[model samples]
Target chain A: MSWGPLALSLQVALAATALATALGVVLAGVLARARFPGSDLLDALVTAPLVLPPTVLGYALLQVVGRESVLGRAWESLTGSSLVFSRSAAVLAATVAALPLVVRSARAAMEAVDPALLGAAATLGASPPRVFLTVTLPLSRAGVLAGVTLGFARALGEFGVTLMLAGNIPGLTQTGALAIYDAVQANRDAEALGLAAVMAAVGVAAVYVGTKLGRRRVHGA
Target chain B: MAREGGALAVRVRVAGPTAERPRVDVDVSFGVGLTAVMGPSGAGKTSLLLAIAGLVRPLAGRITLGGSVLFDGSGSWVPPHRRRMALVFQHLALFPHLTAWQNVAYGVPRRSDGRDRAREWLARTRVAHVAERLPSTLSGGEAQRVALARALAAEPGALLLDEPFSSLDGRLRLALGDELKDLVEALQIPAVLVTHHLEDAQRLAARVVELEAGRLRSERPEGA
Candidate 1:
C-alpha cells in the first residue's frame, strides 16, 4: 500500500511524455512535409519502435546507453554516475516506447492540413517557420493533443523496457507497472489489485480523452 | 502610397501534363492595374498564378517584378514568402482558427501598431463588424472581404485573385468587384484576377488575356 511507486510512475510518465511530445511532433512535421530521397525509409525507421518488441527496443537502448558505451561513459564522466539503472533511464525507456504513437498521430494530422492554406499563408509573406507556427500548428492542435494523451498512456504502462533499463529499485526507479509486477510476484494480492485498478482507470481516462480530441475538427475549417 | 512603376514581367514555361491539364507556356506582363486572366477549367490558370507567386517552380524562363528577379531559368529563385505577392485563394483560405482581425493581423508586418493596421484593413474591406468572428460564421460575402483584407494587409508588391467572386451572388459580386477595383487602383500594384466570367474580366481589368490548354491564346485591351 506504499504510494511511492505510484508517485514515481506519475513523475516518470510526465517527464517521458514531455520528451516524447517535443521530439515526436518535430519528427512528424518533417516526415509530413519534407520530400527527399529515402523519406519513406526514414518514416519506416521512426515507426519501427511501435512494431518492434519492447525487449528488442530495450536491448538496442542498452547498446546505445549502457555502461562502457560512449553515452554511458560520457554521462558517468559528466554526472559522476552511470545512466543505466537510474530514474533517467526509466524516463528514456518510456520516451522511446511512447514516441511512435505521437509521431504517427501528429504526422497524419499535419498531412491532413490543406496545402492551399499553407500557400495562402506564404503568399501573405509569412516565412516557412512563421507559417508553421501560425497556421500549421494551430490547425493540427487537436491531433497533437490526442497524440500526447496516447503517448502519456503508453509511457505510464511501460514495464518491460523500464525493468530492463531502470530496474525495479523500490522508491527509486520502480514505477507503478513494476510495482504491480512486484506485488503480484510477492503474493501481495491486495496491493497488486489496488495499483492495477488505479492504472486501469488512468489508462482508460487517457484513451477516452485522446479519442475525443482526435475526433474534433478545427472549428471553421 | 501607389507604386509609381515596375510591371511584373513573366516569360516562363511550366512543365506539366497532369491527368487534368497540359503544360503551361506563357509570356505576359502585368502593369500597375488589374489584369484579368480568363480560361476554361484545366487550362493552367492556377498554375500560372502559382508560378508567379513562387509556389510552383517553372521549368524555364524568368519572372521579374519591377527590378527584382524572382525566378530565372538558372538557379536563382526566391521562396514564396519573400516574393511580396498577395494571393487571395478562390476558397478564401482564411485561417479557420483565427478571428477575422487576427487573420488580417497575420499578414501585417510585425510592428507596435499591427493590430490597428489589421483593424484598418478590415474596416477598409467593410468587415470590421465581423473582425472578432471566425471565418466559419461569416457569410460568403463576409468571408470574401475578410480574405481580401488579409491579403491587402500584407502591403504586397502585387495582388493575385483566383475566382474571387465565384461564390457570391450577382449583386454582392458587383459590389465586391468595384471595391476590389478601387483597392487595386489605390495600391497601384499589378493585380492579376483569374476568372472564368468574361463580364467580370471586362468590368475590372484594363486588359484581359485568355488561356487555352496552358498557353496564352489571345490578349485584348478592355472594351476592345
Candidate 2:
C-alpha cells in the first residue's frame, strides 16, 4: 500500500520479466534443439522450480549468491552489490519462479511446427540456421509471446522467493505482491485490497492472452 | 560406399519399422530426364529419394552427383543445402508465413536478380496470379504448383519429389503430370519422383525405377 514500495515492485517486476523472458528463451531453445544422454534429467531440472518450494529456492540462491559464496563474492567485487535486499535479487527470484512456464510453452510451440517445413526449407537451399530463423522462429512467434507474458505475470506476482532472497526493502525490492503482504500485517486493508485487485487483473489478462494465442494456432498450426 | 558413377549414382540403406526388410538398399544411376520411382507402401521408395537429396543419412552407401561425392563411407558427407538440388516433400512444406512469390523467392539465391527470377519461375509454373497469397490460404493444387515453382526457381542440379501428386484429385494429378513433364524437359535437369500410383508415373517419367524392399530391380521399366 505504501506508494514507494508499490512503485518499486512495478519496476522490479517489469525488469524481472524482461530478463527472465530472454533467459527463458535461450534456455528453451537449447532444451528444444539439443539431444544428448540424460536429456530427460535436464528437462526435470528445468521444470523442478514450478513444483519446488519458493523458500527453498530462495535459500539456494542465498547460498550461492549471498555475498559470502564464490558467486556472491564475484558479484560484490565486480558490481559492488550484494544481492540481498536489492532490486536485482528480486528480479532473480521472480525469474526463477516464472522460468519453467515460459520454457514449457516455448517448447510446445517449437515442437508443433511441422518437421516437414524444416525439411522443405533445407530442400530449398536454406542452411540450418536459415531454416530455423526464417521458418521455425516465425512459426513459433505466438507461443514465445504468450510464454514471455506469462513469465512476466508470474514474476510480478511472486512473493516468497522475492521476500526471502531480496527482502522487503521499500522502493528497492518490495514488489506489489510483497507490498500487499506488508499492508496486511500493518492492518491496512484498503491498500492491500487495491494491490490484490491489480495483481488479480494482471494474472487474468496474462493467462487469457496465453491461452488464446496458444489455441489460435493449435489447429492448422 | 561405392563411388563408381556415370551421372548420378545413389545407394540408400534405411528401412522404416514394420518393413519386412529394414535395411532396404537401393543402388541406381540416372543419366537425364525424370526417373519415376514406383513401389508399394513401405517399399523404401521415399528413403531412396531422401538419400539422394542428402536429407536422410543412409546407414551405409554412397551418392554422387556429377561425380562429386555427396556421401560415402566414413567421412564423406555434404549438407543438403549445398547439394544444390530441390526436393518437393509429400506434405508440400510450403512456407506458411510467406506469400507464394516469397516462397518461390526463398529458393532463389539472394541477389539483385532474385526477385525477377522468382517472378519468372512463378509465371512459368503459372502460379504468378496467386503469388501474393500466403501458402496457408492456397488450395492444395495451388500449393503444389507453388512448391514446384519454388523447386524450379532454385535452378537446382536435380529435382526430387516424394509422392508429388498424392494429394491431388485424379484430373488435377493427370493435368499436373503433363505440365510437370514439359517443365522438366525444358529445364533439362534430371529428376526422380516417388509414387504409389503407377499410372501417374507412366504418364510423366521417361524411365521408371522400381524398388522392392531396399533393393532396386536390375534393369526394368514397369508401367511408367
Best candidate per TM-score, number? 1
The alpha-carbon lDDT assigned to residue B32 of candidate 1 equals: 93
lDDT of 1 by residue, B1-224 (tens): 44445799999888786634447888999999899999999888999999999999998899999999999999899999998899999998989999999889887766566799889999999989998999889999999999999998888889999999999988999999999999999888999999988998998999999999899999998987
iRMSD, per candidate, in listed order: 0.8, 2.2
TM-score of each model, paired residue for residue: 0.97, 0.92
What stretches of model 1 exceed 4 Å from their correct place?
A: B2-4, B18-22
Clashes by residue pair, model 2: A9-A175, B24-B214, B202-B224
Q: What CA RMSD would you report for each candidate?
A: 1.7, 3.4
| Cα lDDT computed for each candidate against the true fold | 0.91, 0.80
Candidate 2: list runs displaced more than 4 Å.
A218-221, B1-6, B15-20, B221-224
lDDT by residue for model 1 (A98-206), tens: 8989999999999999999999999988888888888888899899999999999999999999998989999889999999999999999999999999999999999
Across B1-224, the per-residue lDDT of candidate 2 in tens digits comes to: 12222367786676556455565677788766788887778778777777788777877778888868889966798998888778999988888888888888887866566678778988887778898888878888989999999988887888888898999998989888988889877767778888887787777777887787667764556451
